[model samples]
Target: MRRRGGARRAPAAKEGGGAPSRPPAPPQREKLAVSTPFFAVIGLGAFSAWRGMFSLDTVRVLNAYAFLIAAPAMVLRVMSREPVAALWNGLFFAAMALLGVAVLACGILLFRRLAGLPFPTAVSRSQCLVGGNFTFLGVPLMLAFMGDRAAAPIVIALIVDTALIVPLSIGLIEAGRGGGSPWRIGLRLVRGTLVNPFMLSILGGLALSLSGLVLPEPVDRFLLFLGSSAAPVGIFALGIAAFLWARSGDLQWRIVMPLVAGKLILHPLLTWFVLAVLLRLDPLWVQAGVLYAAVPIAANVFIISERFETGSRPIAVAIVISTALAALTYPFAIWAISG
Candidate 1:
């Protein structure tokens, strides 16, 4: 009887002494919960790319809606509500932009010499390293994870990119061609920045914010409704775009790898160091800056490369790879910074 009783108690003790199997489930569940939204957006895009769901015309229409209507409305609403003071992070913006340019300049020179790339190819590839899909990918992702109120830094970064980095990219491309005069390039830069809908929306919003006048209830509500559509539409369109580009045949691995690495990894790492460690910026601002830095190469890089007649294929491949990979990297970035 004693032996039987001891055996019974031993089994109970073993059960009690073992780690609880249920405790780990919640954390895992929470992680999945956090990641679900991101994947849902990507999945939506992927679904749209499937046959019968979205055609090329459908993608174009969705992109136009997001760019011309939804995004601007969202930007206007957010910027109008945010204080003008919060939008002016000149030091941090300048530091981050200048650092990005410097890094890309070095990359251009290094690839030119070491890789023996032609000047136009080097310039195009370097632009891929520096530019990011901040508007479509970064903006929506920022609004999703950080909320609309936390988007001022991202807007500031967008302005800085348009104002400064873009000119540098164009200048480099033109210089490589030995074609456009410096004055002509400078004028084109100014025109391009001024004419950009994104920039215009930001400026208009800032003006409204600074004016201290509240938007009427109807207008405000309308803007809110329109702005709400930007994220889902933009992300879905991005997914379709990625799917189309990825099927565009073999990549120039030599050029694509370095440019993709620089855009997705090196730029964000350097931005984090400069903003988070050196400047000790607001934690929110640092996260936004780093997140923006980590976005995939912009599609415009291909446009620029094409205009200059160099490295367009490599740029397109880099954009496709970086955008696809960002689906994984973005979640990790949010987790790291949020934690």
Candidate 2:
């Protein structure tokens, strides 16, 4: 009788599967849903710019506000609240360093040998291969997808890009220019990195985290409020930038497409292999690394181009192309990673 009862119970459990529940939505779908609002705002901004509703000066002001004010606040809030030690993942750092070097080398070689770009121009463009729109787009996307778990990885990624990859790329750019010595280039990189608002915020947050000091309630609230404004404003600014570039004459698609392909596809593919396969890090780290890599070529690339007076149009066009294409590529990437 007992055996018969047990058999019946086992059959019942198997048939019902513990409890009735809806199959969870696909992770990729969930991410897309979260992303739609941000993209919508980007479209709105683009439309506005297309209609000539915003001037170039207005776009510049918006960019400044997002960069100097809103983004720094966001970074500080996240970095301050998290424990410093918990945020430092040695494996992630190593993966980032390896990936940066690989991307930089490959970009330079491809441009120099195949496209036959001048060496300095090639070096400047190579920075785009490693650089990403981490500040404006990446942070919002990460928060939407992974929540606070993303803070450490985001911090590490930014540090690698800003402090290491960007500096090295700029150093090479200077060296290629044939005037500045190695020591001068290194010093300038260090000084610029130190003064950057993003870096300053990171350092401030780190200090807060290390000291175990809670911010005063009012101050904390202020940071939170300002930080929350960053995503929409920054993304909108991106659209304005796209519109501005579109009106600036020839796009030079021949160069633009390759740079777009490198940013949206190659970087993420290599990052996944390194983090997910080679290092076998945690899934969150792997996802963060790849997705961040998959973000568009940064607006900063255009800034660098303008500063150096080289490749401005092509780089700007690549930025727009990569960003637009990311809407399709990013969902696919999420699906791949989840799978």
Name the best candidate (by lDDT).
Answer: 2
Query: Which residue pairs in candidate 2 collide?
Result: none
TM-score against truth, every candidate: 0.83, 0.89
* lDDT tens per residue, model 1, 95-146: 7778877987898899899989888778778878778887777776776565
Off-target runs (Cα >4 Å) in candidate 2 are: 1-28
Question: Ten consecutive residues with minimal summed lDDT in candidate 2?
Answer: 7-16
How well does model 2 score by local distance difference test? 0.80
lDDT of 1 at 231: 69
Least accurate 10 contiguous residues by lDDT in model 1? 7-16
